[model samples]
Target: MQVDSDPDWSALLIRVRDHEDKAAFALLFRHFAPRIKAFLRKSGASDTLAEECAQEVMATVWHKAHLFDPSRASVATWVFTIARNRRIDALRKARRPEPEDLPWGPEAEPEQSEALELRQETARLGEALRQLPEKQRALIERAYFGDLSHTEIADETGLPLGTIKSRIRLALERLRHQMS
Candidate 1:
């Protein structure tokens, strides 16, 4: 069959969407499936993964054909966009830690001595923070405690970016020295 000679893909998709026409769906599958697989492989999916994801993408195209907007995109564009999103989802799923690999049950509590040491360190850090010059202390609090970026702090305080960075750097150096 001449698969690439300008068939009305959008019309076929509409048939799949509205009439659930098997002939139209077969035509779309024949035309787009291999292209989707090749696209996935080019985007760095392994052969097996590409093949699997291509099948899934085509299935999605079949099921979601009603969502297709010919005015917004051609059928090829819609199909490839689904293929791309499926690849991204597959990559994310592959990267996720398997449930079997995770540590089970509640975490062990810290030893009493370790807890005491942590409290002491916290006290020292608090004292050091209190001893900092108000300007430096305020910047450090805004950055580390308030969870604001230097740019955000600058916007809030109307300080130059350089001044915010410098004060934070100096404050960190002093804290490091005190901690050590």
Candidate 2:
């Protein structure tokens, strides 16, 4: 059996800087892909989309790692920023205008386009929201998605009002942590 080596980010980064080290790229991909996927999923991407985003992010790392500045951000932060940008691009891709088989007036068309964009963005956000535990996720979905008030959520879910508030607060905290 082959032993897996621990990631040596600084050394791997040096190799990446040389522009010839596929091994370094491999090592970096191995270590960071899961985190990227988790981040995207928390941000509201589905599993498949998050996986694709992770791949795109790593590909970017391979190309742009040479430009990386450790002084600006840690390796984790750098890799995740790449992941975040790629995720935004992927969300944008999903929000393209649909071909109108027939013209439905400019007014209707713009509204439809905006709705599609909102749906794509909401899905991405929901995916991230879903990464939270059932309690936290439910709190968020009820408050925002279902338009429930804190009292309403507490009543509907049979959770204490304080518990509902706390869960929502914690979920936002977790999301903020993952994002930055």
Candidate 3:
């Protein structure tokens, strides 16, 4: 009897992609589905959501099989990346307010005193931001106002990821002190 200790996952995936082989897809699903569910659960999804997302991710794998490039990523890496992106999408969808939750009429404007207070606070924040060292201030602006992730900031600045995080943290601390 030939032992099937290590089946070639890449070959199976290629079969699914090129030939649309049901047997190969079955093998891939059997191997990856449960692991994907467990990963989603560990990433803070409830059991039901994890199971649903896992199913959807596997379906995605089947549908998007042709897009998978073995040279760029292993089969496991591609599947897990799909799962992670699905989780992020699900979280974003869940956080969005429903249409019914939105106010219907024109929103009321703030009172003059409240608007003045907000302007003063904004000015104070601007001054505090300016007080930070230029390097730290730039990082803060990229991370907050620019809406860039630390990794993206690192890539753009050609700095190490740890340095980006540390500068952002120190800048936040200084801003807090100034605001208080």
lDDT of each: 0.75, 0.67, 0.75
- Between candidates 1 and 2, the TM-score winner: 1
Write the residue-wise lDDT of candidate 2 on 1-180 in tens digits: 001233446457758877668888788878898888877776668899889888888888877876664434446556756765675577655433435545335452234445334434434454566678887886675664343568976787788998888878899998876544
**TM-score against native, each model:** 0.49, 0.48, 0.50
Residue lDDT tens for model 3, 23-140: 9999999999999887777556789998999999999998999877554455776786787678668755543332453453354533445433444554567678888999999887
- Residue 8 shift from truth in candidate 3, angstroms: 0.9
Off by over 4 Å in 3: 1-5, 94-180
Q: After superposition, how far is residue 62 of candidate 1 from its true place, in Å?
A: 0.9
Worst 10 residues of 2 by lDDT: 1-10
- Name the better of 1 and 2 by lDDT: 1
